[model samples]
Target: MSGSQALKADALDFAGDTATYALSLFVIGASLRTRALASLIKGASLAAIAIAVLGMTVLRVMNGAPPEAATMGVVGFLALSANVASVLILLRWRDGDSNVRSVWLCSRNDAIGNVGVIVAGGVVALTGTAWPDLLVAALLAGLFLKSASAITLQALRELNTTGASHATPVESSS
Candidate 1:
C-alpha cells in the first residue's frame, strides 16, 4: 500500500462520495425540497471530510515521510481512470440543481485529486521529500471545502425557491 497522505484523503473523500451518492439515489424522484435537503446533507458531510483530511495532512507533514512512489502512481492512475469515466457520464447533468451538481462535482474532484496524487508521487520520488504529498493533500482538502460551500449554497437557494414547505414529510408505512 502507498504511504501517501494524499491517497488516504482521496479514499476518505471517495467514501463520503459513496454515501452521498446512495442518498442522492434515494431522493431522485423526491420533491425539490427533499432533494435540496439531501444536497445540504451531502455538502455538510463533504465539509466534514475536508476537515478530517486537513487534520491528517498536518500529521503527515509533521511525520515528513515520502510515500511509495510505485504504488501511488499505479493506484492514482486507476482511480483517475474510474473518476474520468464518471465525469464523462455525468457531464450532461452537471448543470442541474445542487442534488445533481453535487454528484458531478464529487466525480470531477476525484479525478483532480487522483492527478494530484500521481504528480505528488513523481515529485516525492524525484526529491525524496514528503512536501509534494502533503501539499497535494492540503490542496485536495481545500478543493473539498470549496465544493462543499458551492453545493451548500446552491442547495439553500433551491430550498428557498422551491414551492413547498421546509419541513420534510414523514412517510407512513401501513
Candidate 2:
C-alpha cells in the first residue's frame, strides 16, 4: 500500500473507533438518566458477550485455510468477552457508587471495542490482508485499556466523595 493509502486507512479506522466510542458513551449516559445504571450495565455486558461470540463464529466460518483470520477472531472474541465480564463482575454491587459507575464505563467502552473488532474482521474478509485486521485489534485493545483506567479513576473519585458525604454529620441548630 502507498503511504497515502496507509494513512487514509489509519484515519478511517480511527474515525470509526471514535464514532463507536462516542455512541456508546451517549447511550450509557442516556441509560443512566432514564434507567438504572446497574441494569444498563448488566444488559450491555450481556449484549457485548453475545456480539463477541457471534463475531467469533463468523470469523471461524469465514476464515479458510489461513490461520491469521482464525487467530485474529479468537483474540478479538477473548479480549471483548474478558473486558465485558470483568466490568460486570466488578459492578455487582447494587449501591450505585464510584465503583459501579467505573465498571459501567468499562462495559460501555468494551462494547465499542467489540464493534471495532467486528469491523476489522469485515475489512480483513474483504481485503484478505492481515494488516487491517491487526491494526483494528490493536486499536481495540488500546481503547479497552484507556477506558478501563479512566473508569477506575472515576470510581475512586466517586468512592471518596461518597465517603466524605457520609462522614459529615448533619448540623442541627435547635
Candidate whose lDDT is highest: 1
**Per-residue lDDT for 1-174 in model 1, tens only?**
688989999999999999989998999999889999999999999999999999988877778878898888889999999999999999999999899999999999999999999999999899999889999999999999999999999999998888445568889998
Candidate 2: Cα lDDT at 13: 33
Which candidate has the highest TM-score of all? 1
lDDT of 2 by residue, 60-154 (tens): 34543322444444555665676667566745552454334544554555555655655666566677765565455445444544544554454
Model 1: per-residue Cα lDDT at residue 104: 96
For model 2, the superposed segments whose C-alpha errors exceed 4 Å read 1-96, 162-174
The regions of model 1 sitting more than 4 angstroms off are 163-174
Error (Å) of candidate 1 at residue 40 is 0.6
How does each model score on lDDT?
0.93, 0.46
Question: Each model's TM-score, in the order given?
Answer: 0.92, 0.40
C-alpha lDDT (0 to 100) for residue 34 of candidate 2: 31
